[model samples]
Target: MNGTISLFSAEASGPGLADLAGVLCGPGRMAGFGRTAARLSAVVDEPWRAHALARECRRRGAEAQVSAAECGRPLVRTPFRVDLLSLERRWCRGEGKVLPEGFRLDGGMLRLWALAAGSPQGNNYLLALDPEAPETYERLIAALAQLGVPAKVQRGEEALLRVTGRRRLLRVLELIGDAPLGAEAAWPSPVPVVRAV
Candidate 1:
């Protein structure tokens, strides 16, 4: 079974996103979904991976087409180019699935995951989760805490989990390393802002 992860991008940057995409659509290969446009797609022969791909795509404001080929083969493709700029606004308000079993959120992995799905807006960084999986969100909250990054999980239509404060945001970004394309300028620096007494 050949498995691959695909990511659609206008430019070749965002290694963090690419890494997360690799894990999301991996145990296979990573390549362009098609020649129609600038799209990143993973080719996986297994049904389970395809399902995971579809779920992850939905969570990231994209669509995953399984076996969209001439002969109805098992070739998964996410055609809608993921717009990272507005991803948080889109997915936060939508429905999503739980993290697949055995998916670890260690420092490196978490960094990549954040880069792929996180949104750095205003003074905080938001990570949206599917309200369907409260348990998963709880675990995520705990894990972030373990990493010394305090986060708050707000239950609502968007079900947002925000990492506030410049210190925490900088720590999260430090873990994430380099930001994705179009995101470099937006990455919050490690400089701390002084508050008025």
Candidate 2:
């Protein structure tokens, strides 16, 4: 077998459900809600984030819908998909969603996360994280470094992983592929290099 992760593979395309990890990144969560059918949901501040997440779900063969949430935010949720029960098993540890063992980050995963949590702060691109999950943030830093992109964690109520510099920002943008429609404001911008003429 070839030594590469295929986009078609079920094991999340890179290693350990990276595609699904994208779904769980940021404020996303999976819940069984006292039943066998599991659902994934997240409250995103921007309308574009909700729409983008719904599209990502559809791309993975899951039906998702966007709805208004409290605090005037938009929420993207999947119907109680019995199919997602397996994911719930991996991510849901009793109450909170936790990263599974051997978790790795991939482009698709980064794309989904950047939709809901990425932003440019000054010269750095910041990817938000759940402050409660310190381990997850730690692992994320390691994973990005493995991909040749070093990141630093800025802890706070809403923690952030800061990716700085032109080359690193470009690398991050390359990893996430393309920005979704209406995400121009929420996504990071890599300033084009200008030769001093």
Candidate 3:
């Protein structure tokens, strides 16, 4: 239930789920987007939650599969693959919409960027945002500053945002909410190791 969010429930339709979906679609560690299909795979710690997620996926007309995790790993893998071409055709015919909320657009994009390539070291977190849209990246930087999360953008093939301190990284995480398991595991522990002599 930690990283899982309800996407199809009427009461669960909100910015949080939208943002989480964006992250899943953007740079999903266990997910992939292709020209024809969009696939999502996540390892949840609970079996029921994994089945629930699969049910949601089935309700949305996607192929869903759930498998128990291997020994020593207490997690279940749930994978969903949906045909994007059909979805796009339906969208073009005004059947569905996948627009980010105006107020949370920045936060959503930031979350996607972080999930795609955010690296948290001892006291710093470095994130790379897609440079394909420079304007969007600028807006994200401005929005982050407004929220008091100091980030410096470095221009290159793929623009990089550097969050210099641990406090700022934590604030970023707070704003973005849940991240992928791999990304979460990549974050260095705040408590330094003290080995006994």
Off by over 4 Å in 3: 1-17, 20-112, 177-180, 188-197
lDDT of each: 0.48, 0.74, 0.46
RMSD of each: 14.2, 5.6, 9.8
Clashing pairs in 1: 3-28, 3-29, 4-28, 4-29, 6-40, 6-41, 6-42, 7-40, 8-40
lDDT of 3 by residue, 101-123 (tens): 33333445455445445556546
Clashing pairs in 3: none
Regions of model 2 farther than 4 Å from truth: 1-18, 33-35, 192-197
Give residue 152's lDDT in candidate 3 (0 to 100): 79
TM-score of every model versus the real structure = 0.46, 0.82, 0.45
Q: Write the per-residue lDDT of candidate 2 for residues 130-165, one digit (tens) a residue.
A: 755666877888887876679998876678888889
Q: Global CA lDDT of candidate 1, please?
A: 0.48
lDDT comparison, 1 vs 3, better candidate: 1
Find the 10 residues in a row with the least total lDDT in model 2: 8-17
